[model samples]
Structures are given as C-alpha cells and as structure tokens.
Target chain A: GAGVSQTPSNKVTEKGKYVELRCDPISGHTALYWYRQSLGQGPEFLIYFQGTGAADDSGLPNDRFFAVRPEGSVSTLKIQRTERGDSAVYLCASSLWGTSTGELFFGEGSRLTVL
Target chain B: GESVGLHLPTLSVQEGDNSIINCAYSNSASDYFIWYKQESGKGPQFIIDIRSNMDKRQGQRVTVLLNKTVKHLSLQIAATQPGDSAVYFCAENGAESKLTFGKGITLSVRP
Candidate 1:
C-alpha cells in the first residue's frame, strides 16, 4: 500500500506571495495531521483533520495559515502571505484511526522556501 | 502553544554503545507518548510508542520509559549502531487530540 504522499517536493516563492501544499493520506486512514519543521528543531503541530472536518487546529501559528480537507482523503495547507519565517518543511501524516494513540504514516514532506 | 521539549540538545555515542534520550512534557493529562526518528532530508519515522499506563515498552532494539510522576520520558537504544544516527523527538498527546512534539535530540554515532 502507498504511504502518505505530498506534491511539489520543493517550492520557492517570494515573500508575501501565496502558496498551497497538498497531501494525500494513506487509504483507509480516518485521521490526518499537518506539522511544520524548522532547521535544527522539532516538528510543531499545525492542525489535524478527522474525516472531513478539522478536529484540532489550535496548533496553527497564526491566521495566515489555514488548512482544509474537503473530501476526507486529501488535504491542502494554504498560506495567505508567506514570510521568510514560514520557510520550512511542511509534513503531512495519517493514521488508521482518529486518535493520537495510533501510529502515523508520514510523507517525505514539501520543503517551502520563502525569500 | 507550549509543547514537549528535550533535556539534551545532542548526544554522541560510539558504535555498539547504548544511548538514552530524554524529554520533558508539561501536560500531565497526556496519556500517550511516541518516539520518532528523523533523518536528514526526510520526515519523522515512528520508532516506538508508550502509553501512560505502562512504565516501559520495548521494540526491536529500542525501549521507551515513561514516568508520569516527573512528566519525563526516555528512549533507550541498546547496541547503538551508526545507522541509528538521527534526530529523536518525543511527542505527547493529552486530553486534547493534538500531538505536541519536543525540541528533539540529535544523535551522532561515532564509528
């Protein structure tokens, strides 16, 4: 079975520009999550979706960051006005169940560079 | 938006030695803890997980020890090899469904 997959392995954009990153979760996974990883640091939670609605998004850093999962399988993280600080790897993961107790399968991730 | 964090920034161990990484979490209600290994240019890979109920759980060559009283967690790897070099992060999920992660410890293997 295919693991989680993300598109545009690398993306470079100017500051203040808008961009979107996509995620395709594993089949039969009812839970999906988004995280941000900075250099020499750990991944910070962004948001999580259970089915078609976001179950938890309190981790989102600010209003500039937003995510959506319309059909319950794939998701997209959108940035309204990118900043240099927003440059990092955007990771997407999914699990068999919706709870945090289950193990997660992660994608390689999409590296976003804002200059 | 506080989260779990690591006690040590880095650890350097020789091949065939044992390595222990520590993490401290603030949320006591966090019953679930997970250890993830992330290599350069890749996303985090699940290494092992332990619930608050049990004090210890073992995997292939890795073990997770959780102490709810101190709100601390540790990952022990026996006979550490060069391939085990990577960044280790501990995540805790409390009553909240979100899994907050630690600062991470970089493991360097000296062969």
Candidate 2:
C-alpha cells in the first residue's frame, strides 16, 4: 500500500494476556512513531524509531510496552500483561525524516480492547 | 512536564462561515506546531504547520496562526463546509523528534 498499513484493526484480549500489533510504513520512510489514544483524547506519543534503532522511547508508559522496527520497514508494538487501562487505539505514523518538523503519514490504527 | 490543550471541546459554525479552533501549550521551548484533522474511524491527516519563527502559515482554505508570546495556536478554516466537520488537534514539537498532541476539538458545521 502507498500509505501506512496496520494489522489487526480490532483486537480484544483478556486482562493479563499479551498482544502484538503490526505496522507497515510507506516504502522508503526513515522515521516511524507509535502513539496511544484513549476515548475523546488525542494521540499521546509512545515511541519513535529512526531506521533500525529506537531514537526515543520516553513515551512508553512502562517496561511492558515495547516497539521495534526491524529492517527499518515493518514495526511491531508489543504489550504484556494487558490491563483494562491499556485499551485504546494505537496509531503508527511514518515520515521521510526523523523529525516532527515535517508531515507524518499515519495508518488507520489498531483498536485494542482489554476485558 | 509539557502539555498541550484545547480551549474548548466543541465548536459549531454555519456552513460558509469561518471557524476557529484554539489551542494552548505549556512548553515555552516548543519550536514547531502542527494541526491535524481526523474523521470518523480514520487516522489523522495533516492540515498545516507553523514554526515559532513564523507567526502564521496558510494552506488550502486553512490558516494556522501561532503566538509565541502566549503559547497559543489557532487554526482557521475559511468557509466551513460539511466535509470539514471533524475532530481537530494541535500538536507541538519541542527539542525531541516526537510530537505531543492535545485533546482535540470537534468542529460541527451546520447547514
């Protein structure tokens, strides 16, 4: 796809279970980001990857949330011991540069529901 | 901690009228700001962006104004259309590469 693509558009899991969400950015994009959005709120920065390295993961709520962009193309966000509070829409975006100074192309996002 | 926030949760304007959405940021070091529009069940699309160096930037039917003195940002849509009805968010980028977004404001255009 010419745009960002995210898999598992909807994921419902029980509390304490683990989940993984995938994101495929536009070809040739060097920068990728992950954000979490709860109901009625905007996306909160989660992590940022420049190429194969995570330049910043300061936004990760805790050690349980982790993301990786291997080969600098496809990325995955992993969550462990999912809690009800973790239920939200996880959005992935990519840009040509590793900075927020430019426009970012975003995916449709993955909606996670914890029960 | 830095935070971005919108002035209001919702704004209603008549079709063909101009609409303005306001946002405020607590970080004084932010240098870049962006506005994004999100429709139902869709990801946010970029609208326009302004740097702290410039006070205003204009796009197709959209204008973004930034005030560094007060740390305020406003997005103006000329001649609001039904298609313009969506949730709008203002984001700020500081020294870090990541962007911090505020709670969005829902714009409703009434015909």
Instruction: Evaluate every candidate with DockQ and list the scores.
Output: 0.72, 0.85
Candidate 1: where are CA atoms >4 Å away?
Answer: none
Q: What lDDT tens digits, residue by residue, belong to model 2 across residues B57-102?
A: 9999999999999999999999999999999999989757889899
Q: Which regions of candidate 2 fall more than 4 Å away from where they truly are?
A: none
Model 1 interface DockQ? 0.72
Candidate with the greatest DockQ versus the true structure: 2
- On residues A4-111, what C-alpha lDDT tens digit does candidate 1 reach at each position? 999889999999999999999999998999999998888878999999999989889999999999999999999989999999999999988854558888898999
Q: Rate the local accuracy (lDDT) of all candidates.
A: 0.91, 0.94
DockQ of 2: 0.85
TM-score of chain B of each: 0.96, 0.98
Candidate 2 Cα deviation (angstroms), residue A113? 0.2
Model 2 TM-score? 0.98
CAPRI quality level assigned to candidate 2 from its DockQ score: high
